[model samples]
Target: MKLYYTPGACSLAVHIALCEAGLPFTLAKVDLATHTLAEAENGSTDFYAVSPRGYVPMLQLDDGSRHTEAASLLQYVADLAPAAALLPPAGTVARLEAVGWLTLVSTELHKVFSPWLWHKETAESTREACKAKVALRFAELDRHLATRDYLAGDRFGVADAYGFAIVNWATILRMPLNPYPALQAYLSRVAARPRVREALVAEGLARD
Candidate 1:
């Protein structure tokens, strides 16, 4: 499998998932600023050729089949290695709970951050609104995480990977994480995982 991704993007969640699953895969760096893939042999390829939406986190399987969307990719990679227990078994309430956390992180946290960070001309009011919404979500997460080590359950799993990816943005966006100590601690715990650390270094987000 080959995963096309932009460094520090939500694609990092999938990358961490792959590593945690102990899967063999190659990384293809996508220059989102140019909407091109930087290939060592081919120079560059139009990213749209992989996905019409021109987004990162496009996973191309060995058979030439492709999967998009960070949440879906997270589940796919986790399901690929059930023994890893990256996610709970499918068709169970526990699995749905994990999906619910992914959805919240993607929709509530990730979407709120994207516009403010990507759009330089975003209205001040809109930026403030986004910050307020993010704070509300963070507060909720903080309350939940105060008792649990992970989002889906007591063990680290796919939902925690997705949450960590989005919440890590708070530091880059200059958003204060001081108010959500539990959430902040959760991010630190996820970052400290050996597989996640490997994924971070592979994406050039970390050293060694």
Candidate 2:
């Protein structure tokens, strides 16, 4: 499999998952500025051909099929290595809850922060609005995380990966994480994971 991604983008979640699952995959870095695979004077056209949407986190399977969406990609990678405990078993109540949190992270938290990160035109207004909304969601997760080391209880499931990937945006966007102590600790824990560290470095983020 080949995962096309931009460094430090949402695709880092899938990258971390693949590493944790012990999956062998090639990484194709995308230049988001040009929406292409290679960094060149003129961007490589190959990646855009594979994913016309021109987005990162496009997973090209062994069979040459492409899957988008970080939330769904999390499930796909988890199923690929069920023994790793990345996700609970399918069709069970526990698994259902895991999926619920994944969806929430994607739709509620991830999408809410998307607008502010990509533009400067209305970033201030959008960020102020999103700050209040994300704080509520962050507090909800903070309360839940305060009692557990990982999301979905003792295991580090897919939801935790998605959550960490989204919430880590606080640093890049200059959002305040100091107010949410539990959430702050949670990010630190996630960052300290070996696989996650590997992903962060691979995505050109700091090794620390």
Candidate 3:
């Protein structure tokens, strides 16, 4: 399989999962600012043809199929190496709970934070409103995290990876994580993981 991603985007979640799963895959860097894959030694448009959507986080499988969406991509990578515990066994209530949190992080938290960064017009009242909403959502995450080491349970799973990826946006957006100590601690814990650290470094987010 091959993964096409932009540095520091949500694709980092999928990259972290691939590392945790111990999967062998290649990576193509996308220049999202240009909406094209960076040139190979000779330069090319192959990746663009594969994903006309021109978005990062597109996973192309060996069978010539592609998977998109950070949440689904995380689950796909996790199931590849179930023994790694990226997620619990399927059909169990625990697994369902993990999926639920993944959905919340993707739609509620991730989508909510996106607008503030994409549109300059949102810099006024709109951005403040979104930030207020995010604060309430973060408080909920903080409360839940206060008692659990991970979003699903004591063990790290797919949801935590997705959550860490999206919530890390707080750093770039200046969203102020100080009020959500539990969530802040959770981010720190995930960041400390070797695989997560590897993803961060690979994405140029951290120095080797």
- Candidate achieving the largest lDDT: 1
What's the true lDDT of residue 136 in model 3? 89
lDDT of 3 by residue, 1-208 (tens): 9889888788888988898889998888988776766756245655656677768799989997987888889988999998898888899998899999999998898888875766787767778787888888899999999999999889988788788888988898777899999999999999999988998898899877
Top TM-score model: 1
Q: Write the per-residue lDDT of candidate 1 for residues 131-184, one digit (tens) a residue.
A: 999999999999999999999878888888889988988888888999999988
Alpha carbon deviation, residue 105, candidate 1 (Å): 0.8
Give the Å error, residue 133, model 2.
Answer: 0.7
Q: Flag regions of model 1 displaced more than 4 Å.
A: 40-44
Decreasing TM-score order of the candidates: 1, 3, 2
lDDT of 1 at 118: 60
TM-score to true structure, per model? 0.95, 0.93, 0.93
Error of 2 at 113 (Å): 0.6
Clashing pairs in 3: none
The whole-model lDDT of each prediction reads 0.89, 0.86, 0.86
Number of the candidate with higher lDDT, 1 or 3: 1
RMSD of 2: 2.2
Query: Per-residue CA lDDT of candidate 2, range 62-159, in tens?
Result: 99898899999999999999899899898898998889999999988989888665677866777788888998999998999999988788788778
When summed lDDT is taken over every stretch of 10 residues in candidate 1, the lowest stretch is: 40-49
